[model samples]
Structures are given as C-alpha cells and as structure tokens.
Target: MKPTGGSVGGFLAAVTPARRQRDAETLTALLQDVSGREPVLWGTIVGFGSCHYRYPTGTEGDMPLLAFAPRKTASTIYLESTAEYADDLARLGPHTTGVGCLYIKDLEQVDLEVLRDILTRSLAWSEAGGSEQAELTVTG
Candidate 1:
C-alpha cells in the first residue's frame, strides 16, 4: 500500500516475454510523463503518483494514481472503472476489462494515443478525487 521504493528498472527488466518488457517500458514512460511523477514498483505493478482513501467500512490505504503490470498473457493497466470511459475503450483495440482493470493482449496491437488519453484522463479523475477511489485496491 506504500511506495516500497523498489527499483523500477529491476522489475521491468525481469519481465518475461520481450514484448511485454517493451510494453511495460512504454507504459512507464507514458504514465510518468502524464502524471509527472517517477514510476514506483508496488510488487509486480509499476505505478505513478499516489493517493490515500478510506472506504465506508474504514479500510483505508494508499494506491498509485495510475499503474500497470506486465502479465504473462497481457498487460494489465489499472484505472478507474471502464464505465466512465466506455467510448475511449471502444477505440483502444482488442482488450478486456475488469472492475478497474484494462487488459491489453499486445501493446503494439492497441492505439497508443488512445491508451495515452485514457491514462491522462484517469490521472485527472484520480487527482480530482474520483468517486470510486476509496475502493481502488492497494494490493497491486
């Protein structure tokens, strides 16, 4: 739930499948640029910026404003609910979505610009205290 202060390069370099490594690197640069914050490793996730919130049940913790993890099958980018950006995701190419997750099968297969816009908008939403931030997981 905290910065851990781990080496971003160490984690990215260790990612399997060269393609995922490239994608992770690309995402790191984009998120850092969009958030104007250095990337930090929260276990397997590379995250930018930071925020703290408490749920109604009082389970409070901090999480990255934006984050992504290079998975064995796809790149998992964590963000606010896709319901808020249904239009954008439609243009993002072949991908899947979870409660607060965007899964890209191949970074190269998706539109980088669209992905960038999503990251930018997601960061803004988090900074503005997005409605569901309190439910945002700190586990990644």
Candidate 2:
C-alpha cells in the first residue's frame, strides 16, 4: 500500500495511553534529528525521509528513511537488516530483531546513544543507495 501522508499529531493522539504517545513523540524527534528530515505519518507509523527498495522478486516500493511504531508491546524500529550494523546491535541493550525491524520494549530498556548511532548509520546507508556494505563504530 502507498503511504497516506497523514498527520503525525493525529496518529500520536490515537495511540492508547499517554506513555505510548510520549514515546512516539520522543522517537519522532530523535529520528528527525538523526535523519534531518521531517516526520511523515505513514498509516500508524512515523516515518522520516524516503527510500526505495526492490526485492529479489522484482517487487519494489518506497519506504521511509527511518520509521517506527509505538505499539502496545514495544517500539518497532524499521531499519535495513545488514551485517554492517552488527556491532551497533550488539550494544543496543535489550531488543529483538525481525527481518528489517528492531523491537525495543521501551526507550528505557535500550541505550539511547546506541539507538542514535543505529539510526544515523541506517539513514546514511539508505541515502547512499544501500548497495555497498559498510561497517560502523559505536562508542559508549
């Protein structure tokens, strides 16, 4: 499905409980700072910037440079799943991964600095056409 270009404020308000809304807001700000792009509400997810992806099957679509969803269970961070980010993930504190997403129980459970590094590297990777594999360093 195509992105809807919805309002971020509306989306945040729809999220249940004040904590989730606050979390989403915090994530939005961080992603914006890291990506240097405005936030776009793609359905329920807050996405920053834009990128194009083509699967091996030739299926291609446009996605955000960085995106996340404040779900009931955790905050789902959308990022490219590449080996280059292995080190950053190792220092990200408590989190889970799926295909191309990083799931954190909450902001407190993970290292914000590490998360910022991950977001920065992810944005750089996406902006650089995401063709070459490059390693990144994470400092505490």
The candidate that achieves the highest TM-score relative to the unseen native structure: 1
Candidate 1 per-residue lDDT over residues 29-90, each given as its tens digit: 98888889989988788988778767778787788889999999999999878787899999
Task: Residues 69-126, candidate 2: write the lDDT tens digits.
Answer: 9898888998878355789889888888887888877676778999899889888777
Candidate 2: lDDT of 129? 72
- RMSD to the hidden true structure, all candidates: 3.0, 5.6
- The global C-alpha lDDT for each of the candidates, from Candidate 1 onward, is 0.85, 0.77
List, in order, the clash count of every candidate structure. Answer: 0, 0
TM-score of each model, in listed order:
0.91, 0.85
The regions of model 1 sitting more than 4 angstroms off are 132-140
Worst 10 residues of 1 by lDDT: 131-140
Residue 117, candidate 1: alpha-carbon lDDT: 94
TM-score of candidate 2 relative to the true fold? 0.85
